[model samples]
Target: MRTLPPRIQNLTNKVSAVFVPLTVLLALSAFAWVLVIDNDLPAAIFRGLTVALIACPCALGLAAPLATWMTAHRLASRGIIIRSGDALENGGTVRHLYLDKTGTLTSGRFKIESVTTIDETLENPLALAAGLEQASTHPIGDAIRAAADEATTFDEIEPVPGLGVRGSLAGDTYALGRPDFPGQQPLPADTMTPNSRDKTHTIVLWRNEQPVALFGLVEEERPDTEAALNTLRRLGLNLHVLTGDASTQAAAFAQRYHLPVSTALMPDDKRQIIVDRRRETHKPIGFVGDGINDAPALSEADLGIAVHTGSDLAQASGDVILLTDGIAPLSDLFRAARETRRRIYTSLIWAFAYNAVGLTLACMGILSPAYAAIAMIGSSLIIIWNSTRGGSLWLRDEHQLTEEDPPTRSTNLTA
Candidate 1:
């Protein structure tokens, strides 16, 4: 509750402050009226007590928190753990959603899609690339190693973070990584490009100073991604891909998914995009990511969601965590938040209306103390019932994956 926006807390506090004193004045007026008209002290005291009790803002107090509690329970059952209630509240207002590419949209598993070599006479380029990447743990390196023959071997390997790997093979030095690596030349313009629709990423293999081949690797999108994106779009959210991948690949992926793309981003670059979007759009921005590289962007977003499978740093930095794979839970989260907000408004509206009518009748002496008590209890019950209704509306049929659905597992990168 303390984390709730100050405006909301202040509004509630102000209402409560005025309400208590107003109720007390109403009770005093009732007491005086009844005593003067009926000449009965006991009856006046009873009416005064009834007015005070009925005017208590129990329904008002329960409006937001009760709905929030119910929403938390429903979302927990659906594999989304909300770390902050305030975030959940704010999530309903999000108009833009920025998603990380790896481990979020894509499966984070890389596989060698195809390999192209500049020299037909050269032995398998994949084998040489694998030999150089054998000691590396990067997803791309692992993919190259997995595609190569098991007999491939290397000596004196040196790994460069975010670039590639280098090693001595058969008394010759070989490098396998990005084309822009130090002393590496770019592929010729006449070189055949991979299918743009496939959106494959390229890693260059170098034999000493000469670029020998290009390895095309692909990351599969999660099965639930399309449906989740469609749902968010239907909810009027502007979706954009914020990725550290090259602009060409990111643009391809975004085109395939029909979303805007921001590419070639550093960690700080991703944060800056979000900050700029927030300022320009003046709406809440939700970011979903699952890597140490995503921590800054996640923290910078208005609502940050991390997958349970993400790195510890990402999980800790996120406002919400998905216990399961895929983006289906994100849709559920937004639906639940929207529904919960609706319920709160409904409860508050009904509470205010009920109180207005009941207090007026009590002041006019048209409602007996006994009946006023019943009406007050009935109003609270109505609010509670309204709040509980349709709590599970967020769980869509598509969210329930059948046994036939492909299981999300780490790819055998070094197969």
Candidate 2:
């Protein structure tokens, strides 16, 4: 089960697909024998089997798939395909969403959001920082290179395993890394700390063997972040961001989105957070992630929502999957979930009502096998028809699925 594909997979589903029909076929044959035993009529055999043929819960079978397919088709018009339905169903009940910051919220590209010098060297920080960062392969380094407006040249470059890149510029040696030194020394509470900066760090710089300046750099929140957070808040969701990024960076994102922040999280650390939160509150938690790194957290969440625009591992692990990548698209999903739930409830009621009515007629000897067959078909058709409303539930798609391949499944299936 763990290794199975995300979509309908395995002996269970395949066997279940056929087993229902075969069982019905066999039951009809047995029923025909019973009718013979009672010497009622040969017509009952035809009616029961015909009912099995016509009313074999095909509508019930088609309900989810039809909804899925129609939803997928509807989403495709907006450049998305939903290859998973159970994931969506699970995500709807999410009262809390734990998001992976790096690729899920932030673009995973670092640019110097804003630069402030810890000392008094703000003027040439961009050029000098870019020169040092040009030697490293870290995401922050790449972001530094991209954000530097001024071009810089570097001399002898040395890569420190945990600290940062050390390079020379104009006969000066510099190290750029996290300000809270990596096991070397800890900064005091007021060691030229950056204020009003939350949730991220840029390249901490030491120029000429002394800490001349610190780069108050961090990841930027998407413009949509403000709106998404507001929507979640309005929906009474306590959104939290979990990340391996600096505590400061996570704080910044949390500030912008109004999400509570937990930072310095490893993959397992994230899983632990979800576990702790679930154990403490027992509220349904949803996770939104786009990286393979998010697989653990996504798996831990009750409603694992992986944007299809993300890694395949995320999609594979998530319970509720968003085919569209926009935060705005979540509103559409909210609507669809409510709609699907409503339809399921409605279908359940109809099933009960229809069964009750048909049973009454059967007990009264008024509903022959033919009438039971018709009633059964009617019962499921109502469910299928009701569920289709999920397709019309619309929001916007950010159209983020161009890079990732959609998981394959039977295209003929719906819902």
Candidate 3:
């Protein structure tokens, strides 16, 4: 409530500052006229009081904040935590949406789709890679570790940012990461053919500067991803994917979903994409992401949405947090924002129109002071009633659809 734009409050304050004296002047004019015509001082005073009471601006004061509070409450019940009311206010106006690939659109959990060994003597390459990645916290590392034997161990594992993990075992250094890790020895040409499909990401394993194995890992799009994209498309948003994954992998995923993709982006690259898109489109951009790398882009977006399962940094940087696992709630969020905005405008118009009518009646001596007070109360009640009319209908519809169409996980192979 406190975070809502002060435009409405400031406008009302300024109007009230001018209104009070003008209202007093109108009331005094009425009083003087009644006193001269009817020769009744008490009746003239009553008319003056009626005019003052009718134009009190109580409904005007309550209009914007009350609508904001109602919408916030409604959104909270639907598993969407709005960190900034301004985000909610502008959510409906978002014309461009940039979604992250790994966690936001697809399941972050990756599984080994295939593994190829360059060295036949390198036995148990999966176990070796897992051992090197055991201490790392990246999703790919976790996936590798989870697929391998838990008992495997390594010595002094070090993570190379944007590359892979490296460590030593029995005086031999082993690394598990992208094919280009160490920026020296690339993966053998034979292993590159398997990634041509570009549906699955490849993780390379190296032993003492020699490329030994290539592990193909696959990530499945979330079951709700297609449906969510469809819904957003229907809402007229221009959707695009901005990912740190390889160009082939990101392009393949975007092709499957029929959305444009900007691939192989660094953290700063993602932020720059948002800046460039904002300038090109001249519209609000909403970015959805859930990783440490996404923090910068999330902060740069006009409206940033972080999933509940996202990294702590991502969640903190986002303007809104999806308490639920999927993106389905985003549809409801858009509807709620639009509806809330509509109700605010409705309340403001109704309040202003009601005051105008009531003031005219009171000034003309057609309404008594008591009746004017009742009318003022009635106008406030109407605004409150309008604000409370739509109660989570969109959320209920989304839940029903979810129940009818349960989410299923399916994997894709990427290079």
lDDT of 2 by residue, 1-415 (tens): 1232323223235634775776466546645765876666665665455444343334434444555455546555654444455544554566666777765676555556566565674457778777876756555677777877874778777776335677776787777776554433434457545533555464567776566555555555566756655555555456677766676556656555556667665567778788887887776677787765678988888767677667677778875566554565665565455455455546545644554455444433455666667667776767677766546443534331222212221111000
By TM-score, the best candidate is: 3
Q: Per-residue lDDT for 247-276 in model 3, tens only? A: 778777877888788777778888888898
| lDDT (10s digit) by residue, model 1, range 1-415 | 2255423434556777788899999999999999999999998988787787677487877777767777887788878887875766778788678888888887778888878888676787877777777666456766777787763677688876446778887787777776667777777766636523347787887887678888788886788788877766666566777776777788678667777777666678888888888887787889999877789988999899998877788888898899998887787788777777777778888878877877887777677778878888888888788777766565655444433222332111110
Off by over 4 Å in 3: 1-44, 119-128, 135-137, 150-176, 180-184, 206-212, 360-366, 392-415
TM-score-wise, the better of 1 and 3 is 3
TM-score to native of every candidate shown:
0.75, 0.65, 0.81
Q: What does the lDDT read for residue 43 in candidate 3?
A: 97
Which ranges of candidate 1 are over 4 A from the true structure? 1-14, 33-40, 112-198, 203-216, 398-415
- Clash-forming residue pairs, model 3: 198-414, 198-415, 199-413, 199-414, 200-413, 200-414
Once all C-alphas are superposed, what RMSD does model 2 give against the true structure?
Answer: 9.3
Any idea what lDDT model 1 has? 0.75
Report how far off residue 161 is in candidate 1 (Å). 9.2
